[model samples]
Target chain A: MGNFMEWLDRRFPATQVWNDHMAKYWTPKNFNFWYYFGVLSIVILVLQIVTGIFLTMHYKPDVTLAFASVEYIMRDVPWGWLIRYLHAIGASAFFVVIYLHMFRGLIYGSSREPRELVWLIGCVIYVALMAESFMGYLLPWGNMSYWGAQVIISLFDVIPYVGPALSEWIRGDFVVSDATLNRFFAFHVIAVPLILCVLVFLHIVALHKVGSLNPDGIEIKENKDKGGIPLDGIAFHPYYTVKDTVGVVVFFIIYLGVVFYWPEGGGVLLEKDNFTPANSLQTPPDIVPLWYFTPFYSILRASTADFLVVLGSLTAIAAIATPFIKTKRSNKIAAFVGYGVIAICLFIFDAKWWGVVMMAMAIVVMFLLPWLDKSPVKSIRYRSLPFKIAVTIFVLAFISLGYLGMHPVSALSTIQAQTCTVLYFAFFALMPFYTTWGKTKPVPERLT
Target chain B: MSSNEESSNGDSTNENRSRRRFITGLTSAAWAVSAAYAAVPLVLSMTPSARARNAGAPVEFDFSKLQAGQMVKVEWRGMPVVVLRRTPAMMAGLDEVTELLADPDSADSVQPGYAQNPARADANKNEILVMLSVCTHLGCSPVEKLAVGPDPEMGEDSKGGFFCPCHGSKFDLAGRVYKNVPANKNMVIPPYQYLDENVILIGDDEARNA
Candidate 1:
């Protein structure tokens, strides 16, 4: 029987994927709530993929009839309604979980050194997820799918050549037609799944390779007096599993809270007119994206022209990509300068843009990170005030965006959006100026 | 002693005759249920209740009224199905799609247990084959596109597939839709068991013989 089991194990690959190299892990004590987000993100990704597969069975993809078909699935097909909600809510949970997970990296300096690739891979996964979600949003074939694709693809039109023809080719017919719908369906159901699966594999590979980072910024890798056995680290199973289970439950509560009670996640699900088929003749009354995107879209919507719009768009990209730059160990003075710039960006963002400017500034810090960490902290006792301040700035900016997103006045919304937009870009554009002189630890060799 | 033996013989013969009559009654009872489907329903007013519409329960139809080449709509619960008697051309056209159908043998498609063989409906060139019109792709009603036309967007090789009026997806006459269409499976074919020459009941166990 044992030999049979061994043969079975060899035939299937799960044993290799989950055992030996992966199962041998240690988690430090005092690792905080932030440590759990990475696992939580993984959990949500699996849930989304499973639900998404079931949903594809019932979804329609033609421009003429996608909306009504979704309604049919919701109304008639057995258990289909549940599957649709599971997928929609699952998507929102994915973004929320990832944001927290990203925060964990930001707070603990997990993006530094040997772990930077993990952070970079995480960023790559996030970008791929954004593409996946965008393609998915198009599949429902509602007015938003039509207009959103119209508006977004139109952004591609900003490119110098192959703009109009490219858009025409993309739509397949003169406009978003049956061909476009079917093709987008293919991309959403098949192409994105393949890319996402690959990215996820890489992201986990990077994460496992680095072990984990803790809140104290201390390595739990020291040995006992004999120096043979681990003194602090614990195996990830049974130890962190107990902790992650709690995190999982909390994540589910929030996930269900959004799915069951307020499934729209604030007017995003079943966007009222999205029930209607795509009609180029009429536009949706309010053209907001899913809530996860409103903060960035708000930035885009705030500026009215070509150049400013370009700036706003660039600012948003720069914001999401900032961590890559801010964690570098090369430029202490500039890193410290980046610190001040980040804080000022946040304060000015709150006072001026109502907070978007701060988030944008923080994102600039992220891009500069790979080149910024000149700090030579040899001991674990050194403090990082500038990074702390930068993180604080980021939080303030995030709050500002969320708050202004909820604001009723159109003018105030536009102002808040534009204010954050400028500070956001300025933070990135000004990064080279700041990173030349950041602060750092003295020297570990001469530690007192 | 001789009188007693004669009385006993008389009783044995009477019992054997009674037993034969009972066996004959049981055979006719089974036949009556199925025969009711095959031959009973042409008498319009004598329709069976919903309870009688069991799996492969013979459904009675008045073929007397249905026009050739035209369709008659029937309801089983809330779902709608079309009962059509194919013209010689329609049957000939079905042959054209023999290669395209994922399961030309009707391996996985639903039908009456009695109609297990190829062509699904019991007997070849039969007047009726029941089909559920709902598209397997999301339950949208499929519009019939019987013949090839100038669909500029459809590929040159595109045979007239039922175009989903909702999404411009197309399916052939045999109910085999294209690969890229939203639907993952072909339209459903309901089970129909035939009982008799003119009086056929739909949805019965014609498979009892099989």
Candidate 2:
């Protein structure tokens, strides 16, 4: 086996590559529970792909047959129910892991400075995954899938002259139909998954190049031993690999629990309305997107037509003025102007378009974090008290927005959603100012 | 450097540069043409398919069996078009509720020219109301609450109309949306005309074009 490996190593850099990334690669010894999500995410991605491939064998993409075909998989094919549930639950689990992984980056400031490329790649992967999930949701040919696509696809019609035409092109028809279903299947099964895999690979490669940031915001590479390994670092294979297995086992227990007992994720992972096949003429009384998208969906619903223009102009002004406004006094003046603009726009424009803009800005604002944050320290542990409070409030706002998105729209819920939306953007927009106001603790020279 | 040597060297270099530019331009042009040709089928394939186009063809339904005040739904182009045979009282009720509607004049909404009257029905045929069943807000179907006077869902003082259960949007007998609903516009009146006394055709009301 050693002789064969040596021969293979001469032809390909198999051993060298493995040693570089795994066996000999050094990671921080102080990695905690949050760090487990990154490895768990990879495991979920593989599960989705394997289960998804098996599903495609039994699944029919044609509109008329799609609903029945899924039923067939659930009943007729032997143990096909297990595979379907695995794939369905896997999608939700992927988001769970990904959101935690991204939160880890946020709290630890893993996206700071040298790690920006890794973060950017991860963002791209996230966007691709969203597209993949959306396309996959349509394949079931259920009522929610149909109407959800209809509502989302119609969002393009707000763009003015070319809007209607562009939406028509996307649907390949006047409405969501067989054509849209077929095309979405192609994208979901092949194109997007390929892109997601490539982006994940690139993300890891970039992370490896920069090395990992620890909880204390200390660079382990700065304190290397005589053998070139960091004093506070351990080999990734023997140390972190074993640790991640424990996380994986624990995760699988919960994952299989959902698969066996609560595959629908209590009407969140899979919606109840989705059981009914799509009827284009009769829309469901209330249509809500999957849970993962509810946060942005709530924001979208909060904007009325007139408020949209105000929100748009305000967002534009803030994004543009970010570089120009250097002083705290100027930021305060801009904030006052922003409030005034919001007040005036409420009286004039509609909230419909503004809701779309806000929902989109919710995702777009995340990409600006590496630059938006001007904090002196990297980790939240060392950051000032106010910064921690701000992050906690932001998380609360996000979770609340997500919860609100799942329910029927009401006047009170709309008000609540709007307030949370404001907080969500303010967290990022005011980061440059508030981040600089606080006193940060000194980072340790090495991992404790 | 000698002038003769510099001129010869410059001439050869210019010739080589032009040759390179020519090849580059030629290759780019060929690639552009090929790409355009390749995209033609893809673009054409994206248009509405044969099944989709055929789905939009005019549909005819018999209204003879449709009783007065009864709404009959027929599918045309994959959309539900509701035809209601309004009673004399329902037709009279339309005018009384004009003050309660968002688009009382139907000026901001789409309908055939024949439906421009206060009744929003065909000229001289005010008893028959034809409109798409879809709500203008988010396309949910509005249930008929055609019972006159105070109802549980709509409110007291409600004259029978359609009330969208999804968003609480109300529409009068003439399909004009009530004010302060999530739906801003009146229900769309599809291009429709009576082919005969018993049969009605949707998607081909020539009276508007004429």
Task: Give the least accurate 10-residue stretch of model 2 chain B, judged by summed lDDT.
Answer: B161-170
Docking class of 1: incorrect
User: Which predicted model would earn the best DockQ?
Assistant: 2
Off by over 4 Å in 1: A4-17, A222-229, A268-270, A304-368, A373-383, A402-412, A426-448, B1-210
Chain B structural similarity (TM-score) per candidate:
0.55, 0.77
After superposing candidate 2 on the true structure, give the runs of residues whose Cα lies further than 4 Å from its correct spot. A305-349, B1-37, B67-69, B85-103, B117-119, B135-185, B207-210
* Interface RMS for model 1: 20.8
Each prediction's TM-score versus the true structure: 0.56, 0.87
**In model 1, what is chain B's TM-score?**
0.55
Which predicted model would earn the best TM-score?
2
